[model samples]
Target: MDAVRNPYTPGTGRKPSALVGRDEVLETWRVALERAERGKTDQPLVLYGLRGVGKTVLLTQLRHDAEKRDWWVVQVEAGADVGLRDLLGEGLYEPLSEIARQGLGRRALRALKTALSFKASYDAGGTWTFGVDLSGASGGGADSGVLRTDLKRIVKDVSLGAREEGVGLAILVDEAQDLSSDELTTLSMVAQAAAQDDWPVLFAVAGLPSLPQTLSEAKSYTERFHYSHIERLSHTDARAAFARPAQEEGAGWSDQALDYVVAESGRYPYFIQQFGQSSWDAAEGPVIEIADARVGVARGQNHLDSGFFRARWDRTTASEKRYLRAMCPGGDTGIGTGEVASRLGKNLNALGPTRAGLIHKGLAYAPDHGIIAFTVPGMESFIGRQPE
Candidate 1:
């Protein structure tokens, strides 16, 4: 078998040949999109999980599925530096343009543009003003300011326009935990306004475990999101994930070999693909042997180390690295706050900012009330072999 025909994709946001154990989530989204198009209301979605769990991949797949159903979509990955307004503006450009041409009035169209390219200014009372011209007299409310009011207006226009075009509007956001408080509030307002008008607007956001809390803290109403947990695959699905691609390529996998790959990869989708590719490359004939899988496992470990964990490790500062090194003993799951603080010889309160920083950087997360863990799987192992 030629290597060029490998059916596995293990890179960033790449959809693998067999997207195993994800049919339930995908089907849920399919129904939501169909219902939205039919003017039915549903709570927006919030997808949360650890790193390398296929959230980004699922977001892309959902967007593709929506496009197939004649829905209009705007998608973007949120970041620390990327403000929500600008992020939305960048992703929404083509969709908004299409909607504007579909028949938005001059005023609504202008409002959308100003909100897209906002310039901040502070009034005498130190309140920031965005110059958003809402048609009504505004004293002061959550929906008053520029980003809030105008973002709502933008959604109203886009969703209504999409309805006129006989399609639904889906806002797919990845790395959504990085969104600022203001940005999150505005996004919630947009969804609320669309719901009120019976406009078909759907929001699907993917991020770490804390995403729902972040969104809700930004706006209490945001707690209503329908959360979908995308974690590792089951043993049965894991074996099929590796076997399906090899089978499709006219290659047969031994049960022992498949078992080795599944056990070594421990149900992580990316690792499963890497192991499959390595085993396929190492195979001498049509059948993948246990020896071939061992070689693939070794190679897969190196690949995950040098590529996945190393890249994230290289991005942190010295203090952040130390903070992570302490959490490594916790392994894939995570370490308790008091334990990590004791390991760092600091108070738990003192390490709050540093801990929060790691979460903000997407390097780690606090899965429980007082426990911290790296976002990537087996991150502790990567940290254990480090110099400091």
Candidate 2:
């Protein structure tokens, strides 16, 4: 019971061996990957959710499964500063380079070499540079549109190359919400082109809750992609998530302990893992009991305050902090924007800044058309710990 092996990492990519409670998602991912292998030409997939909801874990699992089936996988983290060239050049070049080396043909390899060698440079001071080198791809050009076009061509070429080599191609992009509008547009065009050619090129993207809407805004074609929203585990799934790892480890927790942890965690996977780890660490005997859970809760609460909760809190503006505090009592039920504005006695327009700020920091999310709520359960407890 030396804790649940730190399944809930804060900022790093998902740890595959530590992932749990995603069988349903895994099944869906399996179907997509299988469809790609069969050359079905289905629309790409988009996975979105609030922060810490295990979207990363699901994507990582899918990547592993695809690789097992001999699919060539490319991964990129799309950020505000990321460009289409950076994503494509980094993601596609290595695999395509290897394919070229395997003698796919001189033209394919040379085109790839040209694409990868195109470099755009930004000076450490303030200037920009653009030119093609045999060494790297750069971000500065007339427009990212050109870079995006080149990227699409590379993906198409690579997919065709992989098919000839008896493999499929899968592109995985994480943090996709931060991708620029133009970049998303280019990606959609690429997917469409691949489909037209009847090539098997699968795109699996994971990002914040707004990603689907944002992608659609970028390109209407994105509306056609399959979207999966990863959410918190159900109570039963939460209990199983906690109990399964312990069972596999040759240890067990008392029913009371499990119930207490689940109730307190509100079925959030991150919280469940946090509580489970704390309980495992605090248990005095092989079988964790109620008393051990009490100790674990205290320890876990401390960890939440200092670790998970404080990090997000520290990143918010003063006004956003006020809005979060005002919404504390609502917990996961959240509050309407109008109610929050009324409670704060601020102009409705002013609330826009606060709402956007909160959403950007990942502390709040839109639960429905008009209701905004804490992104995680037990958020009130964390907000209550804030300085007065």
Candidate 3:
């Protein structure tokens, strides 16, 4: 039979088995769940990393595992344009309403029904809008802080009510770095209050490398949140990632093909998936050989060149694109900021805007010891294909 089509995706979500090299993340999630179950009211947890490092996949897996254990999970992504009330109204209130409608007692259900109906007056154009006036039954007050506090209380009350039904609450937020300073502070306050009350509320957040510090700056109590920085896979795990999928499909890979896949992927899970999928497609028969590996690498490179990398590359200005081409060859060993600046013949300060843009786009990352490099393996190849 032909090898299985690559179910793994770069920008989209996939399963743990479909994803390669995330054992550490899985274990961290398991420990967090255990702690929550034991009633340890420790602070919430944050999973921070560069984009394409499998943070999203890890969180998705955690949500699935939490559900299997009967935990009530809510997921939200804080976008650049999303605001505080919008998030609270949509992300928090909607879920609480659903949970209440399904299982809460008549009194609790009535409370929710009252709140939902009071808020319904603001619903126009099919979007729920909250007014600045603070006299409403939903607790809108002139003071922004008071309004935020009331919203937090509402969410906490709903969460506590759910826990009484034997379901722990977990709120998973992605792109957390995009949250406004006020919103971050509000969330931190809510989390701290939940912990103090011994409520079964856990937060799992994923964002850019700067997220932890941002959270800390938002609230001093946020220092208690556990931090997990997702990294690329080890060589051993990288090899297994390539082999497992082939074995699962009743197809096999030759020794040379395996080595080439690992070397080319540089142990990045997304890159490994891309390479494995392309290689399996290039295989002549059930067994993938050395020649198949070569064709697969070429095909994978072409796919990225035209699709993944090109989409990001085409969005930059001319000078920014030039800077990217200068930094493409370092591979696993990335270039220092000074070295990159020198190659571009521009002062480090002058290139700051370009560097920031690249980082924001997830095309580059800061490795340990402050070295900046490509976010994905084989990205250097993609950068080279850009017009100089």
Best by TM-score: 1
Worst 10 residues of 2 by lDDT: 121-130
lDDT of 3 by residue, 1-388 (tens): 2544543344545553556566766776778777767776556778886556688888888788888887767778888786655555566565554554464554344335434533442333343322222133242221233545555555555555556666577888888877877778878777888888877777888887767767877855787788888777888888887888778767778888889888987777767777777887887758888888888888987886777677777877888778777785673357888878888788988888888887666566665444677655556766665565
Clashes of each: 0, 3, 2
TM-score-superior candidate, 1 or 3: 1
Candidate 2 residue runs with Cα over 4 Å from true position: 1-12, 16-18, 93-111, 117-148, 367-370
lDDT against the true structure, per candidate, is 0.77, 0.71, 0.68
lDDT of 2 by residue, 1-388 (tens): 5544433333335453346567776787788667767777667889887667788778877888888887878887876565756665656556555555455443444345444434222112332212223243222232234655566656766676566656678898988877778778888888888888878788888987777878877955887788888888878788887787777667788998989998987777777777777888888657779998999888988988887778778888888888888886784676787777788888878688778777765678776666788865577877887778
RMSD of each: 5.4, 4.6, 4.7
Error of 2 at 116 (Å): 1.9
Clashing pairs in 2: 118-137, 119-138, 120-138
